[model samples]
Target: MSTDAKTFLLTGGRAPCTLELARLLYHAGHRVIVAESLRHHLCRFSRAVARNVHVPPPRQDPDGFLSSLAEIVNQEKVNVLIPTCEEVFTLARGSGRFPDHCRVWVEPIERLTPLHNKWTFIQEAGELGLQTPMTWMAASHSKLTEILRNINGKFPIILKPVYSRFAAEVYLLRHPAQPCPALSVSPEKPWIVQEWIDGRQICTYSLAFEGKLIAHCAYRTTFTAGKGSSILFTPIEHPQLLKHVEEWMASKKYTGQFSFDWIETAEGKLYPIECNPRATSGIHCFGESDRLDQAFARPETASLILPQAGVQRMLSLAMWSYGLFSVRSFSQWRNWIKSLLAAQDVVFRWRDPLPFICQFLLLIYFWKQSRRHQISMLEASTYDIEWNGEY
Candidate 1:
C-alpha cells in the first residue's frame, strides 16, 4: 500500500451496499476494515475487506459497540469510520468516543433523529418550504382510527411507523376493497398517515460534506422483495431530482449519507416522503470506474461526482426468490430478464467471489434468526442494529 493510503473502518458489513462501498474504498488505494455485529455477514469473506472485526450489536449494547469501535480506530488507525446502516444512530448518540485521529462519518444524534423518523422528516421538510406529502401523526390507536375515519372517503393514504425501514408494516389504505388492519399504536410508538399521491416513486442516495452534496444517484427499484425492500436497483438520474437533493442537503449542512424517497408527478414535481440518515442501495450504483470512489477516499475536498450512466446492481438471489414469481405480465417478465442480463450481481465479483459462495451460509444464519424470533427474514436481517428511539 502507498504511504498516502488511509484505513477506513465500516460498520454494517452485512448490507450489499456496504460491501460495495468496501470494494470501492479498497480499489481507491485505501485499506478497508469492517466492524460488524453479525458473524455471518456479506463482507466477512470479501477480498475487499482487509479485516473483519466482530463488534457488539449496537441496539443491544451501544456502549460496548462504541468501545469496540474506539479500540479499532485507535489500534488500526482508521482514518474514517462509516456506519452504513441504522447503527449510524448509535454511533451518533455516543459521539466523541473515537480517537482524535479517526473521522467518524456521522452527524450528531439530534440532527439525525428527526431525519430518521418518518413523521418528523416530512414535518421538518415542510417547515423548510419543501414539497412534502400531506402527513398526519397519530400517537395512539384511537388517534389513528380517528384520522382514518376522517380520511375514510378521501384519497388513499399510507400508514406507517414514525420510525421504520424497508417499508416494514407500511399499509396502503386504498379504498373499500382493502379493510383497515388493526394496529397497536401508542404515544410511545406513534404512526403516520399521509395522503398517497399517484406518481412515480423516485429514491435518491447521497453523501454530503459540510452541507454540500459530494456523491449522489437517483434510482428506482424495478423489483422489490415485497412492497418495501428493493432487490434490483437501476439508475434514473434527473436534473430536477439532483437539484432537490442539493437544496435539501445545503440547508442541513449535513456531513453523512442522506437517502430520500420522493413521489414525482407527471409534471416533474417531487413530494418528499421520507429520509434515511444512512447508506442505501444507491451506493451500489457508484463504481470505481466513475472515480466517484475518490469522494469517500478524500471527502473533504473532492469535487461532486455521480454514478456514471448505464449502471445497475442487483441481488440475483433476491430477484430469483422474490422477483421472478411476482411477474404476471409478459412485459414485466421481459423487463426483468433484460435487467437481469444487463446488471451485475452485487455480491459476485470476479476478483472477490468468496462472498458469493459464503452468502448461502449467511442466508442460513438469517433463516435461523427469523425462525428463532418468529420474525420475517427482512426484520431478522436488521433486528440486531435497528434503533427506534430505544435510547
Candidate 2:
C-alpha cells in the first residue's frame, strides 16, 4: 500500500529509533508529525519532521497529555498513531479521545496489560506451551522468602517489576544475601523473580497479521546493560527461533510489530526472556534485511535477508570499539575527547548522516548536563526535546 496520502504521528520522536522510523516513513512518502515534550531538543533535532507538537512529558499529567495529541491528530488528519515509548500507554488508554477518522495501532488493554507484566507473561506463555523461564510473583517479605526457598539452583536470579513501563527496578540477584530490595511497597503491586538464563542474547522482530507471521528478522545483542538496546549484530534466519515465534504469535493472535528477547543456553535450547509488544531497538537490524518495507505495509509480507555475517560483525565491532573509546569510567576530559573522535567515526561511516548528527549533538548536550546534575539517567531516558522544523 502506498503511504502517499497517509499522515503518521510518531510519539517519543526524540528516541533514536523513533527518529529513524520517522525518517523511513517520510522517505516512503508519508507526511510525518513528531509529538515530543522537550521543545529545545525537538527544535534542534526534528527539522525533517513535517510538524512538531510539544506536549507535557508523559511522566507528568499522563491523563491530560492526550488532549494535545488529539489536537494534532485533528489538525493533521493523522491516519496512524505510532507510539515509541511508555507514552504509548497514555495514548492507548486514551484511544477513545482520537477522532473516529483516525486509526491507532495498539494491542487491546487486556492483552497489553498482561503482556507487560513479566509474571503474567510467563504464566500465559507457559499455558500456551511456549518456553519461558521459571517465574514467581511476590509482593511481600513472606512471598519473597517462599520464592527464594523454592529455587534450588542458581545465585544470580532476576528480579523485575511485574508491570514496569521501562526497565525500572530490574535487579540481578546474586544470592539470597538480602531481601529483594522492596521494588515497590504497595501490597497490590508484585514483582517477578526468575532463574537467570546464561546464554547468547538473541532477538526477533516481526509483524503478524491475524496470527500469521508475515515478516521477520533476528539479531544478537552485541552490547547491552541494565539499560536496554545498546547495540546488536544482525544474523541470518534461524528456523528454530522462527518456529517458536510463529507459534507464540499464532497462539496469542497477535498483530502489529513485536519483538522477543531469547537466550540460547549451553544445550542449544532457546528460552524466552521477555516480549516487547511495540517496535524495539533491534528494528535497526532490519535495515540489513531489506524487509523494512513489509513492516511499513499494513499486512504481513515476506522475509528479507539481512546483511552477510561479515558485514554485521564488522558494524558491531565498529560500534563496540567506538563505545570503548567514547565511554570512560571517570576521566571526563578523556571521555569528551573520545566522544568527539567517535562522532567523527560515525559521521564518516554512517549511511544516513543527518539523523545521526542531530542525535550526536543532543547526546553531547545531555552528557554535559548530566555531569552537572541537570538530568538524571531516568530523566534522560524520557527526553522528548522539540526542534522547530529547522534543519
Specify the highest-TM-score model's number. Answer: 1
The per-residue C-alpha lDDT of model 1 at residue 351 equals 97
- Please provide, for model 2 over 326-386, each residue's C-alpha lDDT reduced to its tens digit, 9 standing for 90 to 100: 4545674464444334322312224454654565566666666566766554446554321
TM-score of 1: 0.97
Residues forming the 10-long window of minimal summed lDDT in candidate 1 = 289-298
Q: How accurate is candidate 2 locally (lDDT)?
A: 0.64
Q: Give one digit per residue, the lDDT tens place, for model 1 in 1-391.
A: 8987889999998999899999888888889999999988899999999999999999999999999999999898888889999999999998799877788889999999999988889888998788877889999888877887777666688889998888989998888457778887998789999888888888889999998899899997578887777788878768988988888889889898999888888887888888889999988888888675567667888888888888888999999888998899999999989988988899998999998988898899989999999988888899989989876
Clashing pairs in 2: 38-384, 38-385, 38-386, 42-385, 42-386, 42-387, 43-386, 43-387, 43-388, 44-387
Off by more than 4 A, model 2: 1-4, 41-48, 165-168, 175-185, 225-227, 288-297, 300-354, 364-379, 383-391
TM-score of each: 0.97, 0.78
Q: What's each prediction's clash count? A: 1, 10
In model 1, the runs with Cα more than 4 Å from the true position are 176-178
Question: Residue 360: error of model 1 in Å?
Answer: 0.9
